[model samples]
Target: MLGAIYLSQEINPHNVMVNQETKVEQEGQHFFLRSKKDFDLYPTEIRIQLGGCEYFILLNGRIDDREHLFQKLSLDANKSVSDTYLIGMLYQKFDLEFVNFLDGDFAFSIWDKQKNRLILAKDPIGIKNLFYSVDSGSVIWSSAIRNILHIVPNQKVNSAYIKSFLLDHPIANESTAYENIYRLESGEFLVCENGHIKKDYYYQFKIPSITYRKEEDYFQHFNQLFERSVHNRLRTPDNRVSIPLSGGVDSSSIIAMAENINKKDNWKYNIATYSIVFDEKEADERKYIKSMLEKYNLKSTVVYGDEDWNFKIDFNVLKELDEPYPLFNRALASKTLSAAKRDNISVVLTGHGGDHILHADLNYLGELLKKGKIINYIKDLKQWKNKYPLHQILKQNTLDPIFRKTRLEYPSWLKKERFADMDLSTILTKRFEELKWDSKTITAYFNTIIRQTGHEWFDQYLSNPIGVERRYPFLDVKLMEFLAAVPPTLKIRPANNKYIIRESLKAYLPIEIYGRTTKGNHSFLITKGFKEEWNRITEYYDFKILTELGFVNGEEIKEYCERWYMGYRYDLYNASGIMRALALEIWLSDKQDII
Candidate 1:
């Protein structure tokens, strides 16, 4: 939503021409700023002069705590607080550490003329995106990668990124698909001073060691933090917001919390619900969705997901995506956004980060065993046996990590020669090293801060074409920290995942909605789409871009796809690979068109 260029001393700042999308522009001695209209209610960018230091800020999302910050910083509370103005005041007061006080889905850049310093930072949870490329001492940054690519065409592809994408893992650093272009990671910042660029974390994930002895205390804390997150994100024009209600606990819990807040505080807001229905029984959650609607007496815009899937590419949306993505249920996601757009809704709240933050798996069982808690481990094991077969639980939680040297299952179609040096498996290993699996706190941290960062950016950018900003209440930093600090037992019990969420919202949610254990499996939609468009998929493979790029074995991939198509048995892994291969080819073809 915003882009800026800090030119080197040699290049004339006046020669820089920003993109046409820039609604607001500011040029300083060494920097030229351009930002799009993000929120109609707030200015896109703010410029202020304080203590002989010229300051400019471009923000993509609102700072949720700006009002509190105004009082803390002793600013004029009567004056309206815009996102940019509040951040400017914070910087003038707190200096560089101003980033730590921010809480929201935002990506922003701060320019200080007095110090000749330019600082670029992303939010702690990375719900918003910030990408930059440093060339010959000048730096270019933007919320959208396409803007940076438009300025400096990045033709050279990064093989590491390709490997990560194919394997469905993050690149483990700031490297993007294009060489020399970098994405700022969550809680990270880049500082340009004295013609030198230094990168460090403005926020670090410190798992709090404090634990409340009572379960009620944890429940009370969660309700407060989560309600605050939802309330903060609901700050839109006229208090109107849209939600993607899937009938699952994550999305359902958000609505329940919001409704509770509305009734408790005597506040009013409009919530439009959008849902994707399926003809296939395996993929349908209509029964549960119906329960949610009946319980709340709310109507929803229904999207027929089965009718929506096809192997067609929308170049307009595809080109906007900076990299190839094997998006889970693309049709469903697109339809949801389109529905929100049709309703004239600007903000769409999603329940994405719940599984990452709240649902800690049985891996914590392994941790309990490792920590010499034999008695506790036995009790936990007995509880897990009720849900899963005893053999399966032990193999997954205990045997797998100890015996397996590497967690990655290298695809046979991947060219070893092309990725011979990249240690992709070490991605998970490194995270485990930094934070051990001694508790579900560490497990939840791994699932969220480490693993879910890529998906956060992908979801945000996916809504770009539809012009709807997607917000995640579950990814709230305060709520995440609370869940991470709680005992693993509170997260995963004998037969339930996200035990705390299910238990905490008992008053707000109906038993049918909260007590449900299984989630709707939409993977069937992937294979169903692939089968429906089999001929077109084959034709796409004929393009041979992956083979030309030396990243895949063309014959092997074709054979694998043929086996999946002809075989009667369902193979989830093969289905996933075929989808990713097709996605990569489509992206490559789009790249060729651009070239």
Candidate 2:
């Protein structure tokens, strides 16, 4: 498990030493390697030094046809036994385009001494993450930002990034919280040489709707793709797998599919389903979880989702990921990763990207307008109005195109006048703005989830702490491509969202599970956690660091928190606002050295 790669133009003592503890291994000139020790991972670390070029591949998950591809490459090129097929194939191609054929999560870098060029790439769906920072003619990259900061300790925090975090979530695409450092977006590859840096994206999600006609054909196609994704994810020699089941259709459907996978293939892998239990009955889904466990006779592990958990206040522990993330969901995810590691489960499958991928937004109407399907748009608008009032529907569906070009959302946030420099040019890269204007409705929706939410890096960071890999079957490139192409009629029609998934998995999934129309309300859980954690949070509530750095107004934030806990005005959004502030204060406090 080569966890990260640090590259420099000329290695210095500070850059060579990765951390205080682990001794760094030299891979080539100006390249140092580090990996998580003593963990069983598949497609084990591949490193080759070939003909003035050095190639390295690290895996947290297995490639679909790793063995088959290796054999094919070896035979096709007549490569020697000592040679690595992955490197050989890339060298034979003499270009980075061959990375598009990879089918699993990976981060690889090729250093060509003769050509004086280096390329770093990640998987197409961004199941993997690669962060790079260019400083003093050196390209420093690692899977984690904390590692990069260890070398370039003088880097300053980007104030624009913090303001953007307050307005929305993390900065989309490549920009990090620190200047001169950037992460590669999904399907993006970086090329550096001759004092010039270039980045390019290899994959763009395009829905191939016209290719399939029958609804049943789409269902069968979806079933096949999902089964393959599940199967590919489970290709471990350990004969064990972990699934975080929530008793909802997404996770439950994965359970049903995994059951069918073992039965059809005659495999006997032990499947473990981990679920979170709460003190309150409403927050629990015992009834639904029980049925799936009994139906498949699977092993179960339960972690108490305590309402009084104050881990969010413990900045000492929260700094593990070094991201100002709202920690509500991390409660379950952290426990699941730990359970997987304890059980020797190298791979954990979750239903994270399911909602975004399976559920189509109402914005498809905007796309209809672009296509000049005015009659169809009106008909759909009436159905939408039946569910929601005309105002909400029209504002969301009809006004998208006008707002897309005429104005962006930044002006609204800037009106608050809470941040410095009203301009967003420093915060967002030009590529992100281009993506916003160029994308259609379908691409827009996917981009919001994959990039805007920081799903790739956040998911990668969560698992890295425990040395386990996270896979979202819904984010599987094949499944998403098909889902992207299918018409809105298949996605949502006659007031049914995710119509394709519900219909396709109808026979396999429990009717009660697939029939669920509303999502589980965690407001009660959040409210409970909020009340308990607030008491402990205020004990050490200090925003001196943020206010001193001009990231926030200290007095205003404290007043906001006081009003929230005193019941002046509070809801889910307010609670989230207080938590983000708390997270930011804690985050900035930890970075006092740099700030």
Candidate 3:
């Protein structure tokens, strides 16, 4: 949650410390430091010896000059606080033995003067932002890519990354929108010494052995673990919390559990919930949300959407995101987080990882069925074949590459003839080559982070103005291990995705949500809104810049935009590509003088 910049210069140690400290304090986090050696006879070291040589630099987010607990602990020598603090404190205590013990959303760097080395690490989930680059003779770290730009002037756009980002939304792991700048992936650490960088993984997710002997046993264990995860997040003395309630199973389950805890403790804690409602009926789910609120007696607020928020376009919302991200239903979460900041809420709980991990999409079950699980396959086919309508199930086999190729062919509305000179394969192949990583490694990296840490990258990067702290009980390490232990068949049986989770929460959640067949489909909503805006914007952009830039074929780009608005969903791929290209053009135009 804090931004830090560290530099060691042989030319001037004092000047370097002063400059770094000033920058750190300007970032508005507490700033303190201890020298490697004492200069004055009275001891320049700000040392409080707790039977250890580890020097502490404490920063208070909420208070100033509060009673120092470490001082008190030094006096008592045996008193105990929560294990969470102990985990963080021990890293500072046994500096050599345990240089990296961290939890929660944090990024820290440990510098060992004795060995003339430095180690940098991010939270397992990457809820905190950290970026680094080494050039000439110095290593630089910063919380924002812009901050790094302040010190390193030669930064340039990585054109290959730009192509991949245009094809996909968020740049994949370790790749930044900028070329030379690189992000430390989630659950990873970097050790730098003697001008060499070594990267290593500190955490990995593993499937656990199933121990539940009966249905009730599974239910009991799940309930206990679920409650513990919720309780851990609610440890703050003040029980006021916020949940982004969409009337979905994930958010509803969290709200219900938190309310239950408040009731049990005889606490009059306020649960502030927020939801977004679009003007269009197909996009709005406010009616269902109202039902859930009435059932739970929860106080809630709604932020009505305005189609005419001109600032949405002016802000260049896509460029502001930490990575290239898919539209994510047109950035509703960004708007929600903006409102939450206005309300002065610090921590918000979300139901993000539940669907991905526990209630994987029903298609996963169909894949299992295709791999030949007889009864499960038959049941899934009968229940979802009509609803989801998988082509693989209809053919009783996986789709051939030829069929996939046909599906990938550009539509006629896109004007393939106009774009015939553009070599898309060359672009894609160049992106793959630039990544310098195999598809399997990329897939494994994503899977490990999601399973272990949930979608921390989204929570960390998306929340702006000031960052929003987010808690994901579904991605709690204990919960993931438990879910992984359950057989995949039992987890997604009888055409019910997240079968085990649904059954466990049956008593607590509304029956309507549990029995719901369709997930909340927001593509139509986003497509409708984007089509209109894209049309209006492209008219100004196509003539004003696209033709002049020469990187994009302006007429072809216009056709692509029209095809998208004319109700071609696949055309979004092309539309997104143009959007990214336009964004880059704007960025370069603005920074043209700087270059």
- When sorted by TM-score, best at the front, the candidate numbers are 1, 2, 3
Query: lDDT by residue for model 2 over 497-536, one digit each (tens)?
Result: 7888888888887766767766565555454444556766
Instruction: Return the candidate ranking by lDDT, descending.
Output: 1, 2, 3
Q: What is the TM-score of each predicted model, taking all chains together?
A: 0.89, 0.83, 0.73
**Cα lDDT of model 3 by residue, 484-550, tens digit:** 6665545665446677777887877777777755555455544555555665455345634434433
Error of 1 at 172 (Å): 7.2
The parts of candidate 1 lying over 4 Å away from their true place are 2-16, 19-30, 38-43, 76-78, 170-172, 310-312, 315-320, 391-396, 399-406, 429-436, 439-457, 563-569, 590-595
How many clashes would you count in candidate 1?
Answer: 0
Per-prediction RMSD in angstroms?
A: 3.5, 4.9, 8.1
Clashing pairs for model 3 are 169-324, 170-324, 170-325
lDDT of each: 0.72, 0.64, 0.53
Candidate No. with top lDDT: 1
